[model samples]
Target chain A: MNKKIGKHTVRLESKPRIISVTSVVGPKEGEGNLKDYFDIILRDDLNGKESFEKAESDMMYTAVLESIKKARLTEEQIDFLLAGDLLNQLTSSSFAARGMNIPFLGLYGACSTMTESLGVAAMIMDGGFANYVVAATSSHFAAAERQFRYPLEFGNQRPPTAQWTVTGAGAMVLGKEGNYPYITHVTIGKVKDYGINDPNNMGAAMAPAAVSTIYQHFNDTKRTPNYYDLIVTGDLGKYGKEITEKLLKEYGYNIRENYIDCGEEIFDCETQGTNAGGSGCGCSAVVYTGYIYKNMLSGKFKRVLLISTGALLSTTSSLQGESIPGIAHAVSIEYGKIGEKK
Target chain B: MNKKIGKHTVRLESKPRIISVTSVVGPKEGEGNLKDYFDIILRDDLNGKESFEKAESDMMYTAVLESIKKARLTEEQIDFLLAGDLLNQLTSSSFAARGMNIPFLGLYGACSTMTESLGVAAMIMDGGFANYVVAATSSHFAAAERQFRYPLEFGNQRPPTAQWTVTGAGAMVLGKEGNYPYITHVTIGKVKDYGINDPNNMGAAMAPAAVSTIYQHFNDTKRTPNYYDLIVTGDLGKYGKEITEKLLKEYGYNIRENYIDCGEEIFDCETQGTNAGGSGCGCSAVVYTGYIYKNMLSGKFKRVLLISTGALLSTTSSLQGESIPGIAHAVSIEYGKIGEKK
Candidate 1:
């Protein structure tokens, strides 16, 4: 009856099943390691839009529509659309919401928005407030590059610590009950900052928060690392992943055996020349909705934990000599009936 | 058991109560119409901070702490802190969350965040998921000026249609049971864009969406305008308030008698020179938490509907020749016992 477990985790009595999912990406993402996992790939980055910002919105719009279609439901049947993006004021999500015609609640969890949104939608269904809800998020490489750093037209050098912002979007329709992968628990995160200010090194900034949520999820759920088939962090990239592994170990949790970061898994960093790896709201979104969700449906993964990490820093904050605050939310989605354990 | 009503309204049978609320504002807002209602007024806009961004975060942080104190709850007792602001990447909120050490979920409904968050927290309590939750939002004039338009130091001329962003923050603690103003229903909105691109004319851009949600709320709940003692829109400003009045009449609902705009109520436009009026996440926030919430406690208002409206547009999107989108969410807060209707 009481959904609050321990401290921050919510144990959903009614596991909200993700009915259908869709992932859309730019051509560059289509050339990545898991290229075949995506549902739609744009012809180019611009996707015929006048600006990269519109293209980002169009990508999310396509994913939302395709996701609803994949669920075999019309727009009229859906109760709510919960979405957010990395863009300023969340233009991408709002623009996409315009066409959906569902009750919309825009969220902003930075890159961690994917899991944060899922957690909210899961609570809505588990609480028996809504029948069906769509949770989605997005980001664009050129858009982020321009908004966060230099303009795309202005060529600039990047540090190896920097991660490429994925030009993609992903959407999933979650229902009250179904035979699909069900979301069972959600551990909302705390904003943590270790005084890292460099925008180029977001992984370093976000890694602490990723570990904080992941640790709390385990502590509250009373589940060890072995309980999950895989524990995936949002976008900690390569360097942050290493930092997370070490920090998590100090907390007496050794997850290196089954741990993977979406940022690192999205691209073959060596061949793709993606510096550290992929990062953005789209990175974890596409990886989970595209790769992880597909694999779960195939029974390749029975129990999985997704921790979407975010660096809560604006250009203004960094310019004002403020540190990057980080946050990460973990949601548990499992397939096959759990026999009280894995 | 079904909490959702006919369309977008969520009928909270348990009626989560607002235990306590706090409002903090800058010097300019402190000199406005609702001056005496605010809990804390900063001596200066900077509030001894190095930048406007830090001051914004501090204002929200103060409101959060004070609200918790007023509720007689410690940071540890609060289950989740749901907050957002108009700043890019939601830095103000995330930074505030850093010190609280509570589970955090950042929202981005633009200015509508105040209601969007309350709706989420209400559902969480109604669902018996959490015992207590906090919903907060803030915005700063200097921060908005630099981020959305020209820097304050640049001294750019503003159009008469442009509304001044309010420099304030407000927070409220919601609990499952309490003897305070109870939240009864929530109507989530849809993003509506009528192809308005002028950033200076956000009132024009947001008015339709405010009316859209208001009409939907009344229709879904089968409640006439007379059901509410007061009906309020977030920050539609003087001009947008007129638009809403005209549009709602077309919907066959005459709410003009009791309808008031927070943007208009917060400032004496004639004396304050706040162009159209005060507008920001803080405009509706401080007005409601400081003035409206207090009135409800004193039984001056029996039933009130707060529709926090938001204009969803980023500078980049506008620069890209995109139109401004609007979204508004309505939350029903009432004092004393409701005998089915006011």
Candidate 2:
């Protein structure tokens, strides 16, 4: 008995529970601040694969299996797998699903895929359509660069505004109901374009979208930022996080104190040599499923608003002189049983 | 309330009604077998756009507005829009969704996008999470050719097994419940790769997926193919359709008498100079929304199973020596009333 709240938000009455989760990342991410949270840390980017693309898919496959095992369930018991990645035609997810034999639904929300997959998984569970399903997403540094920018052989210098693409994957096992963190609501975002065209400055392009969804979520849920312990944005690096904060303030919300961008949280920008911070589909996914999940389970956090932002653009669109459009989907995860806010 | 049937099928209790639909096609498709069924046919492929990609996006935008207007709905009244396209990062869908403020969920199922969108839309509506939502998909011939194969100006010779990409879009408005045709069941498919590596022979690559899903649907529902007035494979073309028929027969189900492939139905292959048939996200979309919708409204096709098959590979994946993985999603649309399958 879920209800559509206002325009973009849906109040999930069933509050599907997170059964288990797994995070797999490459060596670079293994050295990040949330390193201890990951379940699998590859020694190198290739992870025994011939190419980065294959490695990215294998990372997700590992996450899927690890998460199911963590939840004490077999592949046959899982009803569906909702996954996506920042690759052309969703090759990363497609290849990963091919070996699993689970019913698959391919999703594409650019980097906002983490929440996009989670939102769909939660809704399907809340709807009583399935007892169990998995929501997962992944991205690789080398794979994304080749697909979205110049080839690796070109050795072009990245602009200062550019954020490092996280080489990682995250998977979450969601059940109909459990004592784990409850996904109580989801706010789907619209494509918001501020006419930012530079592909290197995705944070700038996606900032407005992150703000818009967060603001809409606040209004629709009839709650302020203080209602939750934290309000996190996916891959909006330090600069983009600043923009989002200012934008939200203009909309009558001041979330400055309780906000943290996953891009900034994942890496120490200055020491790590990552121009801005970590950013990609995996940036928010690993942070949420690994760091956030662990914190929530340990009662270190109560309620959290996770808004995964994405820049909706392909190299072709950029070449065709189209401005980058951004979108963000927000999911409210509260620790406790159903009807328990804290 | 929905019931999970057997392994992969869902029996939707609400039976969300199809409120309205629209189909848009280009000049080439307009001259095809189902010419009269299209809602809007462009005089040329460009449709006044600067490029085929933009034209494809605009065509879908037209379908979105046309379907909404046909249902007497304003964009504001629409709760969500689920859309996808056979473009990188879903550029066509993302751009089309940008102009509309409706909250969007981007899907990527290659050619299977049409049914993927419909299945999610139906579930959300049946769950009472959305009062009205739209499911849409699209593809463009020139755009696809340049992206997937050679440049349009390359003048590459087409192989006999090659299918022409369709220049079209299809959109449908789904509501909570009404007297319209009911969406009662959906069988989400797994990725099936039979190691078909030839990019030109997508029919062979996707046929196994089509058959696997259809056979699974029949088995899970405990019903034979005769229960439906028509059973359509999205765009498996002539050869794929034959393979699907032969494969289903081995599974103890015969659907030859009432079976048709959208790819085969969309164009007169021999006359149109299309080697295999029409195959793209738009192929099944236009065929279903244009041809099937008209026939159903005219008291034909009472019960139908629409399985949209997708070849889940990108040019990058192919170049990286990967085989084409395929997935098919099946949805059951029954006419007249909820309890009346006939």
Top of the candidates by DockQ: 1
Q: Assess every candidate by TM-score.
A: 0.98, 0.99
Residue A56 accuracy (lDDT) in model 2: 98
Off-target runs (Cα >4 Å) in candidate 2 are none
- What candidate 1 gets wrong by more than 4 Å, as runs, is A338-341, B338-341
Clashes by residue pair, model 2: none
lDDT of 1 by residue, A142-198 (tens): 999989999977889888999999999999999866689999899999999999988
**Reference-based TM-score, model 2:** 0.99
Interface RMSD against the true structure, candidate 1: 0.8
Candidate 2 residue B178 Cα shift, in angstroms, is 2.9
lDDT of 2 by residue, A1-342 (tens): 448997899988888889899999889889989899888899999998999999999999999989999999999999999999999999999999999979999999999999999998998988888999999999999999888886779998977789999999999999865689889899999999999998889999999999989999999999999999989999989889999999899999999989999999998778888888999999999999889999999998899999999999998899999999999999999996556545
lDDT by residue (tens digit), candidate 2, B1-342: 348998999988888888899999999999999999999999999999899999999999999999999999899999999999999999999999999979999999999999999998888887778999999999999999999998888999988889999999999999876678779899999999999999999999999999889999999999899898999999898888889999899889999999999999989999998888999999889999999988888888898899999999999899999999999999999887566536
**Model 2 share of native interface contacts:** 0.87
